[model samples]
Target chain A: MDEGRRPDDEKGEAEETAELLREYERQIMALPVQEHVERMLTTLSGLALQRLGIGEKEPAACSPQEARLAIDAFRALTEVLAQDEPERGGVYRATLAQMQLAFVSVAGGRAAGKGGAGATPETNGEDDGEAGKNGEGL
Target chain B: MDEGRRPDDEKGEAEETAELLREYERQIMALPVQEHVERMLTTLSGLALQRLGIGEKEPAACSPQEARLAIDAFRALTEVLAQDEPERGGVYRATLAQMQLAFVSVAGGRAAGKGGAGATPETNGEDDGEAGKNGEGL
Candidate 1:
């Protein structure tokens, strides 16, 4: 009787686990597309903002206001990606990638201006001259 | 005159790039949320199917038919995640994680079963006896 009971319990547990997994799968499959996109975009935005040093403890040398504006711009771009038209999605993706690349390039440029390694003295002088010109214009 | 000309050219290029970026950002921002979700879910489904060896050249040892069915199930799940509600996004993410974990678990279980890593000789014999009993019952 004890031997039979052990096998039955094991079978029951296995069944329960399988059922739980099936239920989980069903719930996941039921979610609407907009929700998933929103989640992914939100996650991406956070990652991008962190990389840009927006809202971080140490202020980036670049204007924090400009960084915030850039983040807002990205959010706007994500909204465009969320559209229903199939033709638009590809365009949006390519544009988004381009935007991200632009932001990254600007960040790299600033890092170079901060006297980082790989920045030649000539480039450093050029950056300083540009900064001086920007100050004068301001 | 040459120095002035070069700076003007550089500024013109910079302005042109910035305008292109702004236009791209505007286009993306105008997209509806539904399209965004569909794209994300489709990407996820494709990745999952590839991982499960559904489309890959290096086929897994599992039954191809079974793998196809599993992929279909995953596709269904992605369709569900494409719904419009924000509140359900968390549920969708959780479900995605669970589905991925289930695939990993099944793969690990098959490997362990093949290796006979945890099954003792006595337990194996008992399992064989149980199978024989089931066969006789059938």
Candidate 2:
């Protein structure tokens, strides 16, 4: 008998990738216009958090959960775009600009907070607790 | 005396254009990430509607309001990227992709609905009336 490749090998990966892409596109397509924007905002918030190095152990400036959602949305959007048009270079420029603004906002906000006496960088874990509490509402 | 020299003749058009660009940049910077994306989405939706000959008589298959917010977020993101490195050209690419997707979703959704017997085109006037009436809650 002639040796042949496994039946599932060729189709599995391609199918999986296609399914994933389709799912992502559907999610984006399903989003209400407002929700889509909200998703972008969430992504920006996450980028801001990353830039500020603010986490569970740090002074909570913004909600990490919201930020995470934003990042997920952004990723989904990007994946959908890539699947649709890989060759289009300017397609993502707008999204990038939005992300950059988010980063700057977080950076600037932190800088401003530091400038004031009320928002001092915490030395101990005490402020982390407060941050956690505040982050909960975020 | 030189009567030929007008009172406001110092490259007024160029100055105005520059000022407008700066204003656009500033607005983008101030917007939250999500808002930028929404704005872009709205613009895309409008473009799609125009392409489909769906004029203002019908509500877009997608939410124009939501898309507008996303666009704003994207615009802000782009402004920030352009500030850092105008030559990179990545930010522009991303924005274009997003716009394309938004347009495609609206146009495709309309076309797809038209092609399918089960799918019904929602009239612009009936959008609010049918908001929660159907299982579709987006």
Candidate 3:
């Protein structure tokens, strides 16, 4: 977090990240580490979808409550992963920061008497088209 | 990708990954990075939500095309991230891997003429309860 400090040496950073990963692996031994992260990711993704009302056939199906949960789960885990390893956690930090912003945007938008993600159907529709055309499309 | 050989020095792998991340970042930069990833994440999640169909006013709103798009984008990015940096990219690899599986599940289920994520409503409901107790029930 130092403003003027140089980034961690990539070599040292990688080694430290590897060590932390091993420790995390041991910490999550009760469940397959992959499976645990997947579930949390899926939960967050699913709830975000609902908040956007994309999975629904009706007008709006946003559930801000559920979306918050998914976001929390992601943040909670990533924060743990980030502990004592800012260099290694940079990607997750960026990833979660964007997510946090997007979630807050939606929440804030709704609070301003606008609407949830559903408020921008036209924009979302365009994204769907553009996103659909890019590679495997899946 | 070496099967018999041991992993590279953390230095070697980290350098390679840095190179790859730069490549992927460049590729993504043409696109509004945040919007693009959010769309992909939400698309996949929305598909998952449709499969679950919680809080729905009607039947499934599953879109195979959009779901495929989401899965494709996630895989494409993560695959790039995972190259040569398994140690540092482990979290992203795990994150996207599960998303790919969940997206595939939804897609495969659709192809097989089965239900969507809606098939997993029971489990999702419980998550809802647990999520509600967390702060910021947004």
The per-model DockQ list reads 0.03, 0.09, 0.03
What's the ranking of the predictions by DockQ, best on top?
2, 3, 1
Q: What is candidate 3's fraction of native contacts?
A: 0.00
True-vs-predicted CA distance for residue A88, candidate 1, Å:
33
TM-score of chain A of each: 0.36, 0.35, 0.45
Clash numbers, per candidate: 17, 54, 11
Tell me the tens digit of each residue's lDDT in model 3 across A1-138: 554654566557779989998987545432322233445455455555555444456424454543444454455445434442467458666766666666556554554343333344334333232221221211
Instruction: Give the alpha carbon lDDT tens digit for every residue of B19-114 in model 3.
Output: 998988545433332333344344444443443332345443334333333344344434433432356457656655665565455444443344
The regions of model 2 sitting more than 4 angstroms off are A1-5, A9-17, A56-138, B1-63, B87-138
Scoring the B chain of model 1 against the true B chain gives a TM-score of 0.38
Cα lDDT, model 2, residue B19: 100
* TM-score sort, best first: 2, 3, 1
Indicate the worst ten consecutive residues by lDDT in candidate 2 chain B.
B129-138
lDDT by residue (tens digit), candidate 1, B30-100: 33334444455565555444444544575432332222233333334343343324456565656566645
